[model samples]
Target: MQASNSPSLTRSQLATELGVSVFTLNQWAVSGKGPKAIRVGRQSVYRREDIDAYKATISSTESTPAPVSQPIGSYMMRLPEVLSLSGLSKSSIYAMSKAGEFPASVKLGSRAVGWPSHMVMQWLNDRMGNVA
Candidate 1:
């Protein structure tokens, strides 16, 4: 990982890296259900560093995620990404979402869902520790 200070991704950019439809990401943002994002004149931009920090945290769980030598940012995640990251399932994720226990989904179009990658990760972190 290169030592830098700045976000490497726009909202659209991060979605592509994570392999999810853009509609999903937008939905997450609109609903206030994704990672902390900056609203730049009607656009959301996710910081690369934030994503990396989140990954580093999840990887250090008590169960200790399996060692995979991939750059943290290289693994952008979506709903399926969240399931795979925490070893949860689709139904479980939805249930949690409904209960407002997990990151909420943004509303994209009439029927689309997306979660903020960082928000999901941060939720995991707060779960792992007494985060403020």
Candidate 2:
């Protein structure tokens, strides 16, 4: 992770890294939902270090997020990628998604779509809670 003194990143870049819309991240800034951003003249930027710090904060605050080796909010993933990461069959994933038992996918194009890696992670955490 870069330090607080690292170079800055545009909002678009951060949005891609976190698998969220730029508009959503902008909302986070306005609503104080995500990490604090740096303002360079008329642009909003953030340091890599700040993002890492924010992840650390989230990880620490979560009490019992499943038993996964890593937090869900760390990366973006596609459907096939998610299947591999989760070890769930494709049919099960679709059923879960329809039942709101999983995160919804975001449309990338007319035919292409993807889900945020973190949402899948959160869903996994939620599943762990249902274990009997």
Steric clashes per prediction: 6, 1
| TM-score of candidate 2 relative to the true fold | 0.42
lDDT of 2 by residue, 10-103 (tens): 8887887777999999899999987779998999998877888887998889786575453634655778998987788989887988898778
Worst 10 residues of 2 by lDDT: 1-10
Highest-scoring model, TM-score: 2
lDDT for each residue of candidate 1 in 45-128, tens digit (9 for 90 to 100): 777766676557655754856864644554335566788776778998889989988887766557556676767878899888
Ten-residue region with minimum lDDT total, candidate 1:
68-77
Candidate 2 yields a Cα-based lDDT of: 0.80
Whole-model lDDT per candidate: 0.69, 0.80
List pairs with backbone clashes in candidate 2: 72-118
TM-score attained by model 1: 0.37
The runs of at least 3 residues in candidate 1 whose Cα sits more than 4 Å from the true structure, single-residue gaps closed, are 1-77, 130-132
Q: Each prediction's TM-score against the native?
A: 0.37, 0.42
